[model samples]
Structures are given as structure tokens and as C-alpha cells.
Target: MPKMKSVFVCRSCGFESPKWNGRCPNCGEWNTFEEVDALPKSSSSAGKSSARVARSITPLKEVDLSEASEVRYHTGMEELDRVLGGGLVKGSLVLLGGEPGIGKSTLLLQICEHLGKEHTILYVSGEESARQIRLRAERLGVVGDGLYILAESDAQAIADTVSSNKPDIVIIDSIQTMGISEINSAPGSITQVRECTNLFMRLAKSEEIPFFIVGHVNKDGAIAGPKVMEHIVDAVLYFEGDRNLSYRILRAAKNRFGSTNEIGVFDMKDNGLEQVENPSQMLLSGRPTGVSGCCVLCTMEGTRPILAEVQALVTKSGQTSPRRVTTGFDFNRVWMILAVLEKRLGFCYSALDVYVNIIGGLKIQEPAADLPVAMALYSSLTDKPLGDDVIAFGELGLGGEIRSVSHVEQRIAEARRLGFKKCIVPRHAIKSTQKFAGIEVIGVSSLRQAFEAVK
Candidate 1:
């Protein structure tokens, strides 16, 4: 028998200390430290011995490639497929995270309708009863004959079932509720989430079956568990949108098999989640026409180009320090843009309350959005409205120069498809870009030139 060893772990970040502390040094969360076992000596040594026996090293060139081709499983959603780098790869572990009622489980259940045609799916739920899942599935019209439901929380039991049955696909309602009897920590605790995810990861790889695990986000909008849990998964997709709104955006934060920049848009309907194929059109819908402080910009979300409306309001400030507010845009970048506007372009915004917003819930972190935001501010400040058909995208420099952005051709094509008559781009990018027929492309080197061309 091995002596018991204990440690204090931060529930928020899984930071372990030999003793307890009021505040977690790593995550800065107070009163999060809880006593937990360091590890069972018997289990630790047993795991090490098993790992040594299981080790099989092969030359990189000798690795088999035959099973790697055309093994993707289409989820019956084009937007989701696009975000997933074509389709879900076999034997991959994908973690989908979002706020409560943000449609994480709904997305998985809806996909089963398509995947269940040829593949058997084991849908495991620890948080909800089988009847509750059935009720939701019925509402979503997911009446697949091959979809099996298991309402269990024991991780080892689920692994045993998967190993014996070898289902084509597995869906865990959430990792938070799943736990192993071996571990004394309660379910949803950092240790349980981390260990449970690891169990599923190994099971998915060894069994060659794909997995979709749900994760609940904390108030900080990050997945509730140790950060290691996210690292163990093959892909981490976050569903972003206001619950009060009908739209949701699934963006991949990490993807080992695909690009992380991809995003999937879905519209929440009475039935279930419906994929939005043309996210540009969906975002640009209900856009105001010929409005001052409003302009359209084309941004590339992974390989897809999306056109979003940027609006800014410049008003006289009542307070000593004028407010510089932004929604869906970076605060520090706004300050830099304002500084450039005042210093280089001779536009005084120091005493004005500047408010900038992106029309859709979609956030614009790309520097390509800088030009449009600046243009919107100028339009509101000068009380002049640019042409409704005009679209702008370019990075701004402190020296008052417009910097060229990547995916120039794709952005222009999306704008042209959206029926924009005029396009504004960096002057340097025009040298290599071909002129389009229907739209007038204006290349401006400076903010003044951009404003003059639009005027």
C-alpha cells in the first residue's frame, strides 16, 4: 500500500500547490483552491508500466497513409463542413463549447440525422435523461434509426461500452458531468474534466471513431475546466452569439487537422439550428442605406470572405474625458486610429465621443477593418454620407499611410457579388490585382486620398 499524498488545486485553472492559498497565483481567482489527491501511487505506476508496454515506435516514412484519404464524414451542414476544413475526420476528437442554451447539444443532435444514415452513433448524456434528449431530438426532427442514447456518467463504463460496441460515432452531451469512480474528485471538477477528456481522446484514437464533446463555458466565456482539457482535444470550436439573438457563430479556436480561423454561422429557428450558407448576406441583411457614419468592409474569415457593415458615431462630449467606445472592435486599435486621425490627417476627435460598432455580432479583429472604421468616423464627423454601394478595407499606419491587406482578390469578389459599385483598397495592392469589370476599384495611399476618392 502507498501512502496518501494531497495537494491544493485551483478549481479555475488546475494550478496545484502543496498547500492551500486564498488566491490562485496563476488565474488570480480567490477562494478557488480545493484539496485534491496528488495521484494514487498504484494507479500512477500501473499507468506508467502500461504506457511503456504499449509504446510502438516506427519510422516517419513507414507510417501508413492508405486510411488517411477520403475518410471525412460530412455533417450535412455546408457551413459546418467549411469550418471543419471540409468535413469531420475519422478518429478525431472535437470539443464544442458555448454558453448555456447556446445550442451546443442541439447542433450535435441535428447532425446525427445525417450521419446516422450509414453510421451508428452512440449519444451519451450525463446531464440529461434519455427521455429529455429524445424530446429535443424529436423537436429537431432527428429520428434516425441508428442513433443510440446512453444516459451514463461513469467514464470507464462509457469507455468499456465504446470498446466493445465500437460505434461509428460518439457524442458526449458534456464532459463536465462525466466522471470516473477511480478519481475521488466530484464531476465537473478540474481533475474530472481533464481525466475524462483524456479517456475519450485515447478511446477515439484507438477505436478510430470520431467524437463530439460538449463543454460549458464559464462567466468569462472560456470553457469551464483545466486548460489542459482543451489541449487534449483535436479541435476546439466555440459558439459565439447573444442568447437573446437568433444568430450563432461557431469559430474554431484550435484545429489540429484544419485551419483555426474558420467560422460557421447558424440561425436558431423554432425547429433547431439551421446553417447560414452565405454568412455575408446574412450579416448584411437589414443594413441601413445611405446612412452617415456607416460603411461596408470585406473581411476574410478563414478562406471565406464576409462583408460586414461598420458604423461610427461622433458626438460632442459632455464629460471632461470624452468616451472612446467600441463594440466588436479592439479598444487599443481605436485609440491608435483616433491618434492617426488627429495627428496625421488633421481631424480633431479629442473632444468628441467616438462610438464604433460592427453591425452583426461578428467581431472584426483584422487590420483590414481599420480603413472602414476611420472612414465611418470621418463621415460622421463631416456630416457626409458616402455612396451606399461603396465598400472599404485596408490597414492604417501611424504615418497616415494605408497598408495593403491579404486576400485582396477574394475580398473584392465578395464585394462585387454583394453588388457594391465601388471598392477601396490600398494603393500598393492595386499593382498586382486585376481590375474588375462592373465595379470601380479605387486605390488610395493615404486617409486623405481615400476620403477624396469616396467624395
Candidate 2:
């Protein structure tokens, strides 16, 4: 028998060290190192030996492309399908991570409801019992003979079951709870997560079965596991939203089969999560009319355009350094906008406390949101109400010039559909903005011009 050796691994990046350290040398994260048993070198040597076996190899040109684009499984949920770039590809591995009680399990069970109708699914839960899953499934109206549930946590047992049963789709309720018995490490540890994910990845590829693995998020909001686990999977998706709110946003952090810019929205209810096909309308509903520091903007998420509200509040300062707080928007970017407003627009915001927020729990990262944020700040400072039936979107430069943004026509069309009477855009987009009807489009080249248009 080989003597077991121990090693310390960083929970954040999977960087291995012979001994424990207060900080990870690789990822620069402090106190993330945990001790775990290291796999014997003989085991890896055996794996390499098996890899040397003679196998038939085909040239790239010899491979057939007939089934390349034809093989896609639609999940029956249009929102999910769009995020997956049409549909789920055969033999692909998808990792879904979210905070606890954020509906990760509910979403997977919901998918099984539609996928189970046409394809056999092996549902494996490491944390929940079969009866518990059944109870939830019954509530979600998931009834199908093709769905099979297993409550085992042993990684080897799962691989054996997949090989023998050969289901079309495999759903792992979570990767953290599953572990290899031979590894001598607790479940959710870095070593166990990396090894278990590797096992599932190999099984999914060799057997050509699609896999959906659920992962947990850490305190810092990143997936709680070795970073290598993300690289091993074909895709990484994050389910994000305020737990108190009913709306949920599913965004891809990485995808081999699709674009990461795409996002899927769902409204959580007692029945389950229902897809929001028109998120623009859902977000804009019940918006206050004739309000200061409120402006609407259109942002493109992949091919879909979404309208979101930007709001700001500027009040007299009570302290020497006025507070600058922002929610669902970048703080540094907001500060830059304030600097431009002070230097270029001649706004004296240095002595005021500024607060900015993006409505509906939506996070805006695009530069196109700059102009609207600036406008909202100006409106709040001057105590002038920007009309409810107006929309604005443009990138603001340091020189106070409004820069052109992509997909101007799409943004205008979405604003028009939402009953907005006027649109404010960059001057360079006037040519494309002319085709949009029923909405008054105003082209402006600078902040002065934008304020004049709104007046």
C-alpha cells in the first residue's frame, strides 16, 4: 500500500502548496488554504498508461458536418434556449451556481419537466432525498416516466449508474455534496469538487450525454470551489437577484456553445419560475410619472434589447465628505461621471451627497448607461422633473460630448413599443434614428444640447 501524502489547496484557485499559508501565493486571496489528502502518484501514472493505448483517430477534414448544426435539444423554455444559443448541445456540461434558496434546484427540476417528456433524464441529488425531490417535483407539476431520481453522493456510484443506465441527460443537483470515497476528503472541499467535476466531465463526453451540475456560491459571490472546475465544464451560469425580490436573472459567465452577453429573466412565484419574455415591460411597469432624477435607457443584451430605469439623488451635504452610494451600478464609473459633470457641465456636485440606483434589481455595466446616469444626476440637482414619456441613452466622454452607441434603431424601437414619446440619442446616430416612427428622436452632440432637448 502506498503511503498517503497531504497537501494544502487554495479554495479560490486550487493552487497547491506543501504546507499551509496565511495567503494564497497564486490568487492573492487570504486564508483560503485548506489541507486535503493528495492522490497517489501511482493513480495518475496508471491513467497516463491507459491514455497511451492505440486508438483510431480521424482527421478534421474527414469528420462529417451534416449533424453539426442539426443536433440541438430545445429545453421548451424559450428564455433558456436563447441563453444557450438556440438549444442545449449533446454531451455538453453546464455548471449553474447561485446563492442558497435562490431557486437553483427549482430551475433544474423545471427543465426536467420539459426535457423528461422526450428524453430520459437521470436526476442525481447529493443533498436531498428522493422523497424530498419528489415532493418538489409534484409541486412543480413535473410528471414524466423518463425522469429517474437518485439520492446518492458517491462519485464512483454515479459514474457506474450513468454507464449502465445511459440516460440522455444527467442532472447533478450540486457538485459540492458529491465526492470520491477514495480521496479521503470531506465533500465540498477543493480536492473533492475538482475530482468530482472531472469525473462527470469525462462521463458526459465519453457517453455523449448532456449534464447540468449545480454549484454553490461563496460569501464573495463567486462559485464555491476550485477555479479549475469552471474550466472543466463547457459552460458556467450564474442565477442572480435579490432574494426578497421575485425577479431572477440568469447570466452566463462562460459558454463554449453560446455568447456570454445573453441573459434570461424569470419571475419567481409559488408555482415556480416563469419566464419573462418581455423584461422591458416588466421592469418599466409602475414607474413613477414626472419624477426628478429618473430616466429610462435601452441596453442590448446579446440580440435582445432591455429598457431599464436609472435614478439619482443629490442632496445637501451634512458631513465634510459627502456620501457617494450606488446600487446595481459601478461606483468608480459613477465617480467619473460626477467628475465630468463638475468640470465639463459646470455642476457644483462636490458639496452634495449623491446616490444612484438602477431600478428592478438590474445591474447595468454598459457604457451606454453613462448619459442617462448623468442626466438623472443633473435632474436631481436642479430639482427639475424629466417627463415620464422620454428615454435617453448615450455614452458620455470626458469632454462632455455624447458618443454614439451600437444598435440605436433597436433601442428606439423598444422605447417606442414601451409608449415613450421622445428619445435622446447621439448626433452621429441621426441617420439610423430617422427610420423610427411615432417617437420624437432628438440628436445631441454634447451635454448642453441634451439638456436643451429635454427642456
Q: Tell me the deviation in Å of residue 37 in model 2.
A: 6.6
Q: What would the per-residue lDDT of candidate 2 be over residues 367-398, giving only the tens digit for each residue?
A: 88998999999999998988998899999999
How high is each candidate's TM-score? 0.92, 0.92
Off by over 4 Å in 1: 1-62, 67-70, 220-223, 226-228
lDDT of 1 by residue, 1-455 (tens): 57668787776666789999988899897777777666555432324546545666999898777856548999998878877888899999999987779999999999999999989999999989999999999999999778999999999999999999999999998898899998877888766877788888888887899999998876541234534467678988889998888999999888888898888899999999998888889888999887899999999888889999999999999999999999999989999999999998889998999999998877888999999999999999998998799999999999989999999988998999889999999999877566688888999999999999988
Per-candidate RMSD, Å: 2.8, 2.9
What is candidate 1's CA lDDT for residue 89? 91
Q: Provide the lowest-lDDT 10-residue window in model 1.
A: 219-228
Task: Please identify model 2 stretches exceeding 4 Å from their true place.
Answer: 1-8, 12-30, 36-46, 49-63, 68-70, 220-223, 226-228
Candidate 1, residue 305: the lDDT equals 94
- Each prediction's total of clashing residue pairs, residues at least 3 apart in sequence or on different chains, is 0, 0
Superposed Cα deviation of residue 233, candidate 2 (Å): 0.5
